[model samples]
Target: MRPVLIALPVLALAFLAGGLALTRPVTVPDTALAGLTGDAIAGEAVFWAAGCASCHAAEGATGAARLVLAGGQRFASEFGTFIAPNISMHPEQGIGAWSFADFVTAVQEGTSPEGRHYYPAFPYGAYRLAARQDLADLWAFWQTLPSADTPSAPHEIGFPFSIRRAVGAWNLLNLHDDFVVTGELTEAETRGRYLAEALAHCAECHTPRDALGGLDRRAWMAGAPNPSGSGTIPALTPDRLTWSEAEIAAYLNDGFTPDFDSAGGHMVSVIRNIAMLGDEDRLAIAAYLKALPPAGD
Candidate 1:
């Protein structure tokens, strides 16, 4: 993980001072999003699954919860700050008129329409496992949003990371798995897999990293430091018999611990998404967790 660009002291100061107005870049909508329907309820569930508000509209911002896809939120860490872009319906600023095909490609392949590449920061790797139907629903939901004219902010990075072409190399090395949810299936298992691997993207942040910032599968979801540097994200392993499968699942669904503890950090927002799931989903995820052995435990 290198910074995407080098900066002078004055330029860096201006970026920090202007907040996010330091960079502005755009290409025509490349992903085809025109297939999306106008349905709202199903789309709402998709919204929760994608965690759109986490970066696009932060929980820390005023009206963040209601801001939906209007971009301009900032996520900071040791890597540098990543400004979330507006995805509202606004044609000039946000993604108001994108087609469903565009949305699907962007979510599953991380390829922007007209062929621009999305940085791995978008978490499209985990999202690849998303079912087309669910993705379509999400597309439908985004279409109904209030279009906002808020603009995207530029990123501040240093060195090799600054080169947009470098991301292609990173993707070639790290993005080996295209989202596929095959193998064995019970309905519960499949659903659990989809949520854990795709939309929820649980392992994207919770799994520890290797030297180059790829996932350390050996420690998968065994609790890792938050990349955002906010706080420690809890391990989701089944290490202790005491934690129990049911307890974790329930906690995910409602944010309540067996001992009356509550979800915190990025999880507070995560819980809201999990809670939107049906009871069967919550239980299936619980079953999957209980079945796992903690990494290296």
Candidate 2:
């Protein structure tokens, strides 16, 4: 019995070591963003598409103020409440010192500049599929945005979940770079897929999650309970949202439904950001939503 008890501790230590090795912070190559000239002008479109302002900007900020990226928004989830960090260009309080490689690593690999794993609330899982060139453009545009002195708020996670390194393991289970909508698609549909799956990260909110907090891809765009615990996010699937393609595009553009009801809640911000996109882009999103098979209740 003494020998068996001694071996149990050894086995536990071995298991922990293995887990650490498997979940080590893995970042992209340092040269991933090298040689790509950043275009701040072109990046404006990517900024809107990526919805960077939706979460990072000061809550209730409107119009031009949304570009500040002060990042005090709080997101409540089953695990805990996650706070958006300040990503402005402030030399002391924000990411002003982050290199282009740091930006790529954070967005594509979910690894922080300090080699720590970022919480999934940042939506790196969806941002991972973004085009490298577009990311470079975003970096340029980010530099052009106004800097802020706002300090980032810490997450409200508890216990073992507070350990940031543990997020490495979570990323292993949830981070997927593949396109959710596949098979042959029209040019517009393909663009829409990129916008939906990668830039806008629609599934991050629209899709349901499993027990471990990983997205349930099987359900796709079927709506889920808002992580904020308020109400269900409406499903984009044909089963629930039967809006015609034109209606969908118009709603996205004008933020008004055919019933003349105006957009409300977080969708108001989403519509504002998406409205910055070209008319064709809105139509493309409608096309992609129209093509989806019914999923989830």
Candidate 3:
């Protein structure tokens, strides 16, 4: 019993060390978006596309959380809990002192104000492809918003996971810091890619995971029980991969299926966001869906 008791901490430490050590580190690159200047109109579009109010809004806010962007929401999962941080221009806690470049890199590249890698949990992977002008404009818009003085609460992961430094390793294995990846340019394909790969950010909730906390590419967008331990979220692919693009598009746009049912779960909020986008952008997103690999499940 004495030996067992002595070995417990050693085994625990070893386990944590192994988990923490499987991290990935990356240097965020200056994206095509990094060099553009801010514009108000473009910023408003960016705000809508990124669903800026979703996380930053006060618990009850129905619209933008402009003044209330001092993060108050608590997101829980198996990994533990994360309290969204204040993002208003409050100097002490929020991004008040951050320059446009600072905010741009953070949004587009997953780098923090001074250039630390942000957890993909920030959802920058989708924001990565936002045009440079749009990113800059959003920064300008953020500057005009009223400031919040409240600081963000810290994450509640225990031990090595709580050692934010260990995130350096996680980034190396699972995170990709590059905000944009260039490819052959075509207006239609580019539009589709932008909506699916970036703005719509389809992969975040739909993608499944491995035991080590990395997404299983095998199940990319196949859907999983949201690990917060709510029951299974269900698959996006059509039942038996039978839903056509037109049906999926309709489901996304109206939240009602041709099968005479309605979309639910995480998709409810997603449909609402899509509803706000212009028809062109919405169609682009729909087009992208047709191109996604069918659920490998």
On a 0 to 100 scale, what is the lDDT of residue 40 in model 1?
A: 65
Model 2 residue 275 distance off true place after TM-score fit, in angstroms: 0.5
lDDT of 2 by residue, 1-297 (tens): 243353443345435754669677777776755679989999999999999999999887889999999899998876678999999999788999988888899988888888988988888999999999999999999999999999999999865567666566667668886998889999998999999999999998899987667799889999989878677998999778998888999999999998999988888889989999999999999999877878844
- Cα displacement (Å) at residue 174, model 3: 2.3
Model 3 over residues 20-117: C-alpha lDDT tens digits?
Answer: 65332233444644457778766666666676666776764544443468787777755567777888878988988976666767776567765465
lDDT of each: 0.65, 0.86, 0.63
> Which stretches of model 1 miss by more than 4 angstroms?
1-40, 61-64, 176-185, 240-242
TM-score of 1: 0.79
Instruction: Give the RMSD in angstroms, all C-alphas superposed, for model 2.
Output: 5.2
What is the clash count for each candidate, in the order shown? Answer: 21, 0, 11
Candidate with maximal lDDT: 2
TM-score, predicted candidate 3 vs. hidden true structure? 0.76
Model 3 lDDT at residue 119: 55
